[model samples]
Target: MAEYTTSKPEWAPEKDDENKFACGVMSGIDGITDTTVGNLNPALKNGTMKPKRKMVLSVDDYIKGVSSGDRVTLARAITLIESNNPKHFRKAQQVLQGLLPKTGKALRIGITGVPGAGKSTTIEAFGNMLCDMGHRVAVLAVDPTSSVTRGSILGDKTRMGTLSRREEAFIRPSPAGGTLGGVARKSRETMLLCEAAGYDIILVETVGVGQSETTVRSMVDFFMLIVLTGAGDELQGIKKGIMELADAIVVNKADGDNLLKAKVARAEYERMIEFIRPATEGWRTHAYLASAYKKTGLKELWDVIRAFEKVTHESGVFKRRRDSQLLDWVHSMIDEHLHNLFFDDPVVLGRMPEIREAVLKGVISPTQAVAELIHIFDVQRATQRHVDLFHPENQK
Candidate 1:
């Protein structure tokens, strides 16, 4: 009996890991009396085993799971939204349609800054604080893709070690997927899903690249620009366009030796902010100092955000902006739809290579080449419409 004692599974990563799953023993193939036992087992002949299929969730399943605040279902629904497959697109749209009534109630905040500005650290610290205050926070971190491999590390969840472990926080680091500004194209849809899943605060952390600030600002109620001290002459270029879009400019790393520098930077930003127009109606933009590593000044930051929300809501700017965003979202979807339909047309595909070569070789100007492509694309569409209008099936 001692010789037959249970041993650790061979596949366990650790020798003493009690969580390792136990492997079940299979019965040998009996000659004729019980041929079904082990007869279909691939392991008996060293053949490849059949891979397990993932469970398919219907649109109703997604709606039910998300309505009940089920994290697994929320994640699955998000994956469906991110899918490029047509079937998934239809199903995800249906799910979103069903969950639409539950969305748009969350406070949507967008955070953007340059690289090394402690955006992830700030989000984690801030998120933990929010959770401590009994708030459900959803962090949508846009991860940039590698230029060579086109793959994203999606490291935001791992970076927010404490917040990711919190039951009240949901952190999703989605790949940019080659979209401009490193913002995921499906991020807006995912935010709605989180809202439907009962997250009251939606934090969107941009990739801090080109156009991300504007993109995030378009989607969120409050936009924050996180900066570091010692910006000096380098601040000249960055302080123009994006600064006008920020409701708050936070000078982070305000701890230890950097505290004084942070204060000075905040003052400088405040002075410069005076020259720029406010990002939102009936609100004044200001700069503050904070230290995400020390978890200091974050509560004040939250207070400022709440004040902004209250002021904006009272002034009717909040509802107006949301209405505008909804309309703009519709326009963008229409543009994307037409863009795909245009490029996917076989006539356009056939002419694109030649026109591109012409522009490259200087046979035609870039503008002229674009004009020619548009001309052909328009003609192709017209011809197809005419044919469809008179087709035998249509006549019947």
Candidate 2:
């Protein structure tokens, strides 16, 4: 076979057009340049082993595969949903629209706690128990992004080793991506995908920073806060507003010597609950004791969740919360979209460097800097619509 060959494309206008056109002939390369890595890309030398093209799932395929509970396809569909690519965003939204009817069936629960509070351990135990009882559980951990590496470092699969292997369980760890919420920006969509995949229980584990987890509370039907036995954290939790947000306050690690202390901590939390308004209208928040290691109280915890679902559903609070969540989702997405547009706008980007330097040098106050940036962003946006933010005639 000839190592290299050249032929003008049929689409070329004429032989004379080759001299003027940049794209005329399809030049067959002999091989990669010696400067390139021959060891890594040996296929380029012989051209026998071509790189395989990616397998793309169509919208209908994604919908069918997700609905039929194909784990691999479901995982791939979730990857598509979490993708940052513009093209993927459109495809993902289409897939969600197709699967919309299949979603919203699962009971979504959000769990958060202070650091080292054994949230993962409890979730694993709880999830395994649910799996054994004929329930499908999906555990989603929203890991915090490293400010330096900007990567998701928390390994949920490794932490939930037992549950991850279960056929009835699906565990996905999502990065917060600097979103203020302890949950990922696309977590609501991910939860829907889990529901569509036949998972009846969706457990959302937040970044667990305590306060910011309120965002998680908005998406979940039930929100619970896990706290430790001591370290004066019970009072700290109340001060952080997390206690107010929680439908249940669980004092985990109630075993061995800590059992007595755990009971005391629960009493303190129960006392604090009396001063705070209930998280739900028709529900009262209460503190409970549990031990993840011994697997006690988990069954009771599930019973409480089940009872909450029944009570909220009957009282119409469940539907109202879901409806309110939908509205909040819309408002949040709009805020994020407009935020991205403003910061990425060419005019804003051009002026930001100078304004930032001025603020850093104390030449302008932070408030003044923000006002200037907002003005610039608004003016730039108005110009696109053939209007001016400060035209005298328009102002009148």
Candidate 3:
């Protein structure tokens, strides 16, 4: 005040000085200051933090993404193939056609066991070991769907936390969707998608819902049956057909108190396997003791797998198995499509309730009801074909 001059004083505040002060001189535990306040989120201030919008990609995009081993794109492709929408199906077909050349190069392994057999645990241990050895692994875990909701209760991801987070590992849990083969109806397609994505190994895990063992065996080049110690007799809940389908039977929980029991189980399984024919001509199904907790027997198990691959590949069984799988896949899809067509026809839809009641009331046999429905479906299909032939423009 005493040094007031004609020119404005240097201490005079500007028009927006109050705002600057509020930003820079906020109270703190130590003291207030006249320092410039910086943005906590610089990206947000610069409009760089906005999330990218997800868009439906084209077939070319999918092919590029999968070929480049992009996990996000690979996941999107799998979802598209698994979708129930007709449009998604068409798009997926295009994507698959484009990626076909890159597929059929991965080793497909099917893993299954009865409920509570530590199947997921063993797979996690084994899969991570393979990943550590520099192999990219993809796990297609098929969870059983709720009969009422037809939705999956996905829990495999949680069980395989470590492996699921690995950059070289991919885990997909698909709903079984009431598909009888113990796997999702689209599992074969999904495996091919994984193969196209450059994974070295594909693990197709089943729901272990009995009767799925054979189905998985048909699809995978190698089939591993995991069993637990002290789970009762050698063939307790597992069917004889399952033992016959196994390329290798591993007795899990082979550490701690269960060590001796696991060894006993292994011998018993070995004896049981001897009575059955080998899953492949040159390969003999043997039982091995494993401890998923301690991570023992994993390397040996992998060695066995590599040996089996080498032997089968040289003997031509590997190629033949894949060819047979393709045929099975084609027939399975055809059966599914025909079944869907028969049930989804408008004529059949309208008559289904009435037919069900008639069959339940004993007025018509189940076979007669099916024949009647099929007949309706055939008529409808024939009428549609006739219309398409006469009115070609209306086909689309």
Give the alpha carbon lDDT tens digit for every residue of 85-142 in model 3.
5556666787888899989999999988878888899889999999999999999998
The residue pairs found clashing in candidate 1 are none
Clashes of each: 0, 0, 0
> Each model's TM-score?
0.82, 0.82, 0.82
Which candidate order results from sorting by lDDT in descending order?
2, 1, 3
List the candidate 3 regions with Cα displacement exceeding 4 Å: 1-54, 237-240, 379-396
Q: Pick the candidate with the highest lDDT.
A: 2
lDDT of 1 at 388: 35
lDDT of 2 at 158: 78
Q: Give the alpha-carbon lDDT of every model.
A: 0.82, 0.83, 0.81
Q: Model 1: C-alpha RMSD to truth? A: 9.5
Location of the lowest summed lDDT over 10 successive residues in candidate 1: 32-41
Off by over 4 Å in 1: 1-54, 210-212, 237-240, 378-396
lDDT of 1 by residue, 1-396 (tens): 011134454665565555555553344433422111213344323446652422466678789999998887788788888887555666677788899999999999999888789999999999999999999999999898888998999988888999998889888888888786667889889999999999999999988873446778879999998988885522552544888898998999999999988888888888888888899999999998899999999999999999999999999999999999989888987787668767877788999999899899999999998788787786456446444323545431
Clashes of 1: 0
